[model samples]
Target: MTEGRKLRPEERILWGKVAKSTRALRARQDEVAEYEAEITAMLAAEEAALARPAPPQDVVSPPGNQLRAPRPAPSHQPLEKPVHRKLAKGRLSIEARIDLHGLFQDEAHDLLLDFLFRAHERGMRHVLVITGKGSSMGSEGVLRRTVPLWFSKPEFRFLISSYEWAARHHGGEGALYVRLSRPRRSL
Candidate 1:
């Protein structure tokens, strides 16, 4: 190994090249080792997670002795009384409306979901959903029956504060006055 001795230009160039190559190799080895350590830690964490037992889920036995998963608890707190009063009076102006008069059940469901999602994202507070009084069809309105059930579903429930039949002027039994949850601000 050479100490502080001055060397020929060619020798100096070769030595500098050797030093650079050695430093690069060491840095690469360090990077590989760091990656290996991270991968190992992740694998160990995954294995531990798998080994742990899952928490117990609530199960309910239905009327026909069929077991079913329990519905999640409602996420939204009850609406204030003044809000309810305004809604009932049709004072809280509707920001958006969707009429499901002509669509099939599946189509209505999809459209309603999309409408609510978009309304909520846009910071809409009051929206009207018209399902029409099923006068020609029979005694019960198909959409009227299904709409409330759909609102209670997990996907829709989070976005809704509360809902009720619209005032007679709005559409009476045929339409719903939906109050949407406030849009969450992104970080």
Candidate 2:
């Protein structure tokens, strides 16, 4: 193939085929180069991750302080009450109330915590928490189940003395009567 020379029709047809095939080959080579570059980036990332040092296992205290052993995780169960008797009929009354219906899990949890903490600070004895009977769907009432579990956490156990299903006049199975502890006198 001589540069700038006009070709015969048969030669031109052959040259066109060669040009088309070369373009396709170049396109394929570009695609392969992109793929290889991507693979190289991934390998570099993996090697960098592996070369990093592992985190230290021991916790170090600040200067002038001895390192204390890690405290055990709090138990899931609620603390046992000093006196286990149920409140006498008509004796306990609701001093405050919170309705958790239609609230998301996190919202309900935060609201419950704040309400209980404030009620405890105010020296409130009994409060009502209403978690509506859940949907008839297969999932059922999530809040109804979660509220009690939240109360069982150590943070709440110290503030909440006890809890029981409310009277029918209050909310029956859909609500609970939460008994609060007396406010702790600060030293």
Candidate 3:
């Protein structure tokens, strides 16, 4: 192989002519424009989704086409798998955390409810509730059991969308990741 050297004046002139005679095989792609296009497509998809009537979430009776009065939505729902995975991988963020390690069940319940209310008011959606695993005896803690039960109540249902046990790094079975529902808009 020969070492590369600067082109002589005649070679440069010939190279320029050759370059001028050729054209790009394809137009240059603009990264910024591609990103903008992607965003536009996403927005269109979201709008289309909003326009479609969603399938029923709660089960209906009689297993027939007979339509009953639309019931209120179910209060409790299982945590979403994708969000749970994000929490497990540390990709998701918790807006706040509360520790109920030494507090009694009633106090913990009150605190949890208050914390959720304030967090919702501040527009925080995700939160961590640390209910320490009861003891070395391998039984569940009082708060851990009752905290989830509290979510079943009608009042708590208005506040929480779902709750699930946290990932290992998030205190594993000792803690919960709570997703708060946005307050209903006045229609």
Candidate 4:
């Protein structure tokens, strides 16, 4: 710790051990090779996995011809042009509607599913969902952004037949016109 003074005998031995234990770095290589080796290994693993064949499976045939349930409608269909126009021009009625203003994402999602399911059960053909375009903060609202995407989820696939933006007077970008799937009547 003194100016230009040599270290003590034990201090010199410790310094010697540290110096011998450490290896010199290729500074340029260290700077450039960061994560490159890791990424290459990951990609190589992926390629090798892809190259392997999948295991075989057993197939079982049905005993006889039997009635099967109807296939579900495709998810996330757009509102039909004729129907959209009818709603816009006031020819078709919106049988029900649910406003999602001031609600969190989870609440809005649950409310939407319940409303759609009930409407479908009641045989209602058309409905409206109003998720306000967002606050005046310039960014879109959370519900406004996620509501449409929810329609594509598995649970919503059978409930919603088609959906599209509503007319300006009906709330424009803030609202949606959703057509519900009809429930089957048992014989």
Against the true structure, whose TM-score is highest? 4
| Winner of 1 and 2 under lDDT | 1
Order of the predicted models by TM-score, top scorer first: 4, 3, 1, 2
lDDT per residue as tens, model 4, 26-102? 87677547666886697587556545544545455467965565544475668889999999888999999999976
Candidate 3: give its CA RMSD in angstroms: 22.9
Winner on lDDT between 3 and 4 is: 4
**Candidate 4 segments exceeding 4 Å error:** 1-73
Q: Better model by lDDT, 1 or 4?
A: 4
Candidate 3 runs further than 4 Å off: 1-73, 137-139
- lDDT of each candidate versus the true structure: 0.78, 0.72, 0.78, 0.80
C-alpha RMSD values across all candidates: 25.2, 23.0, 22.9, 18.7
* Candidate 4 positional error at 53, Å: 22
RMSD of 4: 18.7
The residue pairs found clashing in candidate 4 are none
Question: Candidate 1 lDDT, tens digit per residue, 38-145?
Answer: 977975875565456456676766688886676554544454678766877767778899999757899999999999999999999989999988654233677886
Report model 1's TM-score to 2 decimal places.
Answer: 0.57
